[model samples]
Target: MSRRSRPVVSNRVRRFFASFIFDKPAAAPASVIARHRLLNAGAYDEGSGTINGVMLIAVAAILISAVALGGNFLVCVSDARSAADQAAIAGAESARDGDFDPCIKSRLATTLNKAALVICKVDEEDVTVKVAVKTAVPFAPLVSRMARAGPVECS
Candidate 1:
């Protein structure tokens, strides 16, 4: 073939291969490419603003739950202590009357409003009393199934 024709044929073959083998491989959809680039660049970091926000929210939730639990515990403890005091007083009174059952029953009845169980025991010179109180809090049906504060003594 003449030199000029040779150049023409070579150019034609090159163009054919370019079209078939290397034409811009379909540009990945823009969104797909963007996601890949973001991942490759490590755009998400543990110390980033989004992570900090999430940590703050978790801490706040934990603190609120703790406060609620503490409040319920305090209520139960206070009620139990009050019942114990009342029981001791009634037991002492009953000892004077030489009757134990009636005094214990009366004390328990008085503390019903506070949702507590009261027990009284008389021992010669000292009256011993025990109280178990139950309190209801959100989510928890009953806090401290039985909260025992002390055996208040009365002489």
Candidate 2:
């Protein structure tokens, strides 16, 4: 068999290849890397970063919508509770004044407070009323509140 001679790699090429492949891990001169984020940048589409940003925006929008809906629901609950308390107070006053039906006045009070009086009951100079308030939310959910007021009892 005839012996063949192998081509020798120059020191410069060896260093360049080493730096390209091994990241020049041995404190290589940054210049040989050639251009800061210029060429290798094209190797990747960077679309993943764009997708991540879009996903973040969508998540933020959903969170904001939830917060708004929750806030509206809380307001509706408070309004309903207030309306029920006011209606019960009005009914209690009517009972003290010897009204045959305090529910009629309670209905008027609930209406003035932007709520619908669902039920009213009177027993032993005590008045109890249930009221429902509707919110302007997407499905217009109603918040219901019940309150009772009676003459003060002292021992």
Candidate 3:
């Protein structure tokens, strides 16, 4: 019996030639090629240093704003409490004279000078005094209004 023999090409040899010498289309997909090119492109490259710098600046700005807001709130509350105390004292002193308008005006003036809005009134029949304090926080072109401890003394 006679046997026929076929020509053999090693897989590695074929692959090497096919990759380097063949005129066939690239095996890599278009999307993959585009992605590789984009990754290596200098214009699209963003170094870690630039990104970190921007993040640091953003964090600093946020921290500073938080501190400023807290400080402003503290000042507003302190001024409001002082004004309320003054109003109470004046109201008590004026109660004997049956004239509360002077005391109310004095309290309002004190708060207004300290960037606080105040409304003070005394009920003659009930002998109760009420004080309202409003303060504005500074934010450019935006009104940040807050009211603090309204009607400090109802009775």
Candidate 4:
């Protein structure tokens, strides 16, 4: 073949193995080197695509779990608020009716709701209640709700 038609090799291998002095084999033609590089690039792209797919699935799963947890927490909050309101109203009505233990009436009102009363305050016909319920979440420290009720004394 004519010298002009022979493939030329650039300084690629020389840059990567600068310290090695062993007699290297004959350099491959430029076309062969380019083909090898393209094959490696395709393999790299395939591996990258697979990794990205797995990561996307994992992230989507985590996001779905978070949304479900938020919904459960909202239910807990709603139940807690209901318990507080009913307890406060019961306490106020008991006080108005001259019950011996108005706080006992408030406690009885929350019996079926599975809520624990943190505190109950009575001042004349007004009553306030603070309640809490256990949550099915991890690392939850404090979640409570408060409510107040009273009969308007027009005197």
Candidate 5:
């Protein structure tokens, strides 16, 4: 006796044809069923809500901390620039007035602005100043800025 070979049809194809014939589909794989159950394990549990709330609060706190640090950095940069400009103007004015040392006034101005004067140069009526602002934030670098002031002659 000889047996005839029959073509094999995939589960997806069988399911599609079964649906058209109003027949039941095949059962899903064990792994898929297990994953679905695991995903919904804590769906109706009261502890899940608390866990989710705690995660949200942690995320919000981190974001707020980052924004505060960023704002502080910007303030530090602005302070450095302002200090440099004030020091340069002070030095230039002192130079024009024939003060014994223009850099002395520049250093005083920076100190008053809560910054340190890194460099101060006076040439005739022109003055250049560099100031640094140090922040209390850990790991933050010192902010520095430079400015120049002089008498401008226009014809």
Candidate 6:
């Protein structure tokens, strides 16, 4: 006897045919449904969502405030550094130009930049200066910076 060949079928096609022939589960009794409802009544309560949202908003606001304060402190520090450098350069230039007192000009420069001259030292044509800028933040110390400027000697 000659064997007849069968056509190949994909698993997807088999599953598609099988879906229409599955056994259905029996319906639950009314007592079981009531018990399930009673057991899960308090598991999904819904009053804390508002509280959680308010707490998240408060936390985000606090983070934004902290970042703003940190950025302001950084700007104050940069301003202090610039004031010191300008004062040092002024002192050095006065010394090179044969002025009477280089420190006086340095002090005036720092004051005009909203900073106080902390220290001034001149060694020949080189000038070193330290300046301080007061911060608006309560309980924060003054920002201080130091700088030196002089004419570079050619080799």
Give the Cα-based TM-score of candidate 5 against the true structure: 0.69
RMSD of 4: 9.8
What's the TM for model 1?
A: 0.49
Model 2 regions lying over 4 Å from their true place: 1-39, 136-140
lDDT minimum window of 10 residues, candidate 5: 1-10
State the lDDT of candidate 4 residue by residue for 1-155, as single tens digits. 99999887658756435435655555666876898998987854667887999999999999998888777788989999999999999999999999877889888877768888889989888999999887766756346999999998688
How many clashes show up per model?
0, 0, 0, 0, 0, 0
TM-score against truth, every candidate: 0.49, 0.68, 0.47, 0.69, 0.69, 0.66
- lDDT by residue (108-136, candidate 3, tens digit) is 54555353333445555222333444444
Question: What stretches of model 3 exceed 4 Å from their correct place?
Answer: 1-46, 100-119, 123-155
Candidate 1 clashing pairs, residues 3+ apart or interchain: none
Q: In model 5, what are the clashing residue pairs, if there are any?
A: none
Error of 6 at 77 (Å): 1.6
After TM-score superposition, the amount by which residue 155's alpha carbon in candidate 2 deviates from its true location, in angstroms, is 1.5
lDDT of 1 by residue, 1-155 (tens): 77776544565455656666877444445776798888889885546987889999999999998888889878876766666666666656666566746456435644663644544555663566556666556554442222222235679
Q: What is the alpha-carbon lDDT for the whole of candidate 4?
A: 0.84
Q: Write candidate 6's Cα lDDT for 1-155 as tens digits.
A: 33457677887556656665774334455776787896688534565787899999999999998888777788889999999999999999999999989999999999999999999999999999999998765556688999999999899
Question: Could you tell which candidate, 3 or 6, scores higher by TM-score?
Answer: 6
